[model samples]
Target: MKTKQEESATDFLKLVKNMKYFTKLKSDNSNGDLFNVTLKTASYNELNLMVSCLLKASICALKNDNSGYSSASESGIDVLLLLEMALQLLPDEEMQLLDEFHKNAIDRKAEQ
Candidate 1:
């Protein structure tokens, strides 16, 4: 039997996978050229790290208690940090695509 933490981790991973698939589908539907390049050259490890941070941030948001609450900025910062880490890991060619994605994310936040 898996421990509670392990089960939660597994569930989080599944959630992240589904989110990635949806994001990819949305990207493909919106911008075929960008989707094609991202699908072809994206780093799985970086994606995984980004998803993990997102999941954690989501959990924090949901668990807002009397002590304090998680703000959108907190989550956004975490994601940006992960993106920076990913950029460092990727080659110059791939970094451009990641930068585009990062800019899109920032734009979405500004719109919200």
Candidate 2:
């Protein structure tokens, strides 16, 4: 039997997997050049750490008692760092495509 925390973590993983933003690949094949970005799933350890941190943050936030809370900035930075670790798991090719996409977005914004 799965513990409540484990169940919640599994549910969160399922939610993330089903989200198109995370799983979808961006591809545009024009001028005989193919630009493909592959989606990479987080490793078991990475997912566990991320879920644990997120759950702890949520639990702290929901505490109505006069107990102290973690600094918002610290929690936010932890989340960001976790996300960065997840992204770093992507393959080199995928990272390159992502960088290209980011650069294109920046260029577009600059044009406007």
- TM-scores for candidates 1 onward, in order: 0.25, 0.24
Stretches > 4 Å off in candidate 1:
1-42, 65-112
Q: Against the hidden true structure, what lDDT does model 1 obtain?
A: 0.63
List the global CA lDDT of all models. Answer: 0.63, 0.61
Which clashing pairs does model 2 show? none
Per-residue lDDT of 3-100 in model 2, one digit per residue for the tens?
99999999998888788455355556663464455644477566456656656655554452225455545445454555455455435785589899
lDDT of candidate model 2 versus the reference: 0.61
- In candidate 1 the C-alpha lDDT for residue 36 amounts to 28
Residue 4 accuracy (lDDT) in model 1:
100
In model 1, state the lDDT of residue 40.
43
